[model samples]
Target: MHLSVENLTFGYGSKPILKGVRIDGIGAGKVAAIIGPNAAGKSTLFKCLAGILKGTGNIFYDGRPIEAFRREEITKHVTYLPQEGASNAVLTVFEAILLARQFSVSWRVSDDDLVTVSETMEALEIADFALRYLNELSGGQRQMVSIAQALVRNPDVLLMDEPTNSLDLQRQLEVLSIVRKATKAKGMTTLIALHDLNLASRYADQFVVMSDGMVYASGRAESVLTPQMLEDIYGVHAEVSIDSHGQTVVTPMCSARNRIANRRPEYAQLAV
Candidate 1:
């Protein structure tokens, strides 16, 4: 097993949010997405996987309990990039990424770590802005730096929160493309918490939708993103259609009350 979490249960103080969560089927080279509304425990679940926050039940990576592993040990295997606001960085882009060496196999970075960092920067296409201060960069640029730092660890599992929060449509898709290509190239596993349904459907190899602090559905995108799911989770009626290219699109329609009020039954019959 690449990574596995069996029966993960966690909460704040006495309030339970996640109960008996199991994630044993994960494998290498797949990008898994965790999607939910605001305050639906998405980030909490990520912290549990990262072992930054403690939780009940089994949480394993490479067939070992994650909590049992040393912090440095786990750091070498997994990396989590929280949202941009959490970054207190005053360093330049290159400097911030170089800090990733702190979690190295050795206290002092070997030649390999240096090479990895350089290569990751290149792969992320941030080689040009390497010397720029993170705060001075645009939101999109800052996010790229953050990603470069996370990937510099060369981890087996990567967890990202709102990876496309501050980006244009082109940059958003560019980042997603980079993520997919890199993870596949390295055979690494990735989990991203996202809010955009269209992007999630387009990119994620697997989808886990959370509702009311529980998994509403977990499966392939086509299997998971049903019209009923939209209705139940988003509280909207939508028509789900797939084009000839097999890409699914959700066309959310107005509610029944609005539709009825806009088109009176008697008036419609007379027009016909």
Candidate 2:
């Protein structure tokens, strides 16, 4: 599947959040990371793509406009995982995952549904928490369960917002690995909103950098994650270097605000 966005615009009342944002070349079996500074509209963009927010734009999946699909049809092809994972539902982890899978099935849950939920839980290493109440699990555990819920749906396009948030180092790696593996195996188009540049560079095959509600840059990490981009978009001085494993690593040195203030005195207050 190919996912493309063009002239995407959205906002609340008079304040605009996205301005004619366009991204392309995100196809099946590929993981594209959406990176940007705080309040850069990353989450808003994901919401628009997932049909959670009504926005004026063109979103195409597999060369067809997303607006043409019915609600149920869209659900079959797209699964979105938001940033926060806490659920007040009284259901257990297994029940939550099973409910997600059951959305597509008209009949009663069968042996296959149970097996699929079990397999997804195991893949996420949350099988032990199957019987635990969702409200009782810790933040990280709930996040893992939320991921399992998304995976069980087996959508063609997976839109994840900060999927690794609240996770420890080990769990972070595990979640990303599982996502990458699943994307490749099922040829799914995965768009993940990530705050960590190094982690994004390590896992994503492509990068889309957003700034001020628009696309600042898009392409391979090495090409897009340059020192200049760091200074321009993130207002930070950073070093982008290839690690021993041949992966791109970003190390922040200092705030680029001082440098910007020196160059553009009119906007000096941003430095503070």
Candidate 3:
């Protein structure tokens, strides 16, 4: 159930995105969140862990290197919920969910398969729309169905790629909470690529912050999500504060000068 990433590095052709990144340890039953600004190679890191992309270093799950594992074998142990790009085509929600089980058979669906399908549809609260098509459902519902597809495999680890994009606040919280609860209840390890640091602080047990093609910071959510870290990763000045209800709210102030005045001394240049 453990995931170990060692000296991992990747790139497109000329520009390197990850440089000797290594996360050699994670407990069996924890939620690790990866956060960084846009184009920080967050998705690329997730792909490396999921074996969707090739990297230079060794990634071990339990004990074996993930690079040595076949695609089917990888899929059996790790479930990756890709971004919502697949919905650009025309497929129904129910069709998409059913297609998730394509690795099983060609002609028929077994009793156990049907049971899994039924439970997934119900657990994701998409049971009533079981007959609905993809284009027919809202963006939020489509995201939910996409998550359901990933869970159908029930792998040892679930990796998500900005799964909350294009979602409203309510739906975002709902889906994120669902992922946290479901993964913990099932005793599976989960790693989510997140753009929202406040949300990560609220739910994630651990955080990996990426900057300049490398891990700039990592550890618990509180340690990794300081105001300086946000400004260093993003050019914007933002305040990370907790409300009376103990919810983290990220307030981004537009003026660069103010952030310069407020940031810590070591990261004073973040004002620009």
lDDT of 1: 0.80
TM-scores, in order shown? 0.87, 0.93, 0.86
lDDT of 1 by residue, 49-160 (tens): 8888898888877677886789877777888889853255788777788887676445786788778878888877889988888778887888788888888877889899
Error of 1 at 104 (Å): 4.7
Residue-level lDDT for 188 in candidate 3:
79
The list of candidate 1 runs beyond 4 A from truth reads: 104-106, 255-272
94 in model 2: Cα distance from truth in Å? 0.8
| Model 3: per-residue Cα lDDT at residue 173 | 84
RMSD of 2: 3.4
Instruction: Please give the CA lDDT of all the candidate structures.
Output: 0.80, 0.90, 0.79
The candidate that wins on TM-score is: 2
Higher-ranked by TM-score: 1 or 3 = 1
Write candidate 2's Cα lDDT for 43-136 as tens digits.
Answer: 9998888888988989999889989989888888899999987587999988888988866546589898899899988888899878989989
Q: Pick the candidate with the highest lDDT.
A: 2
Each candidate's number of clashing pairs is: 0, 0, 4
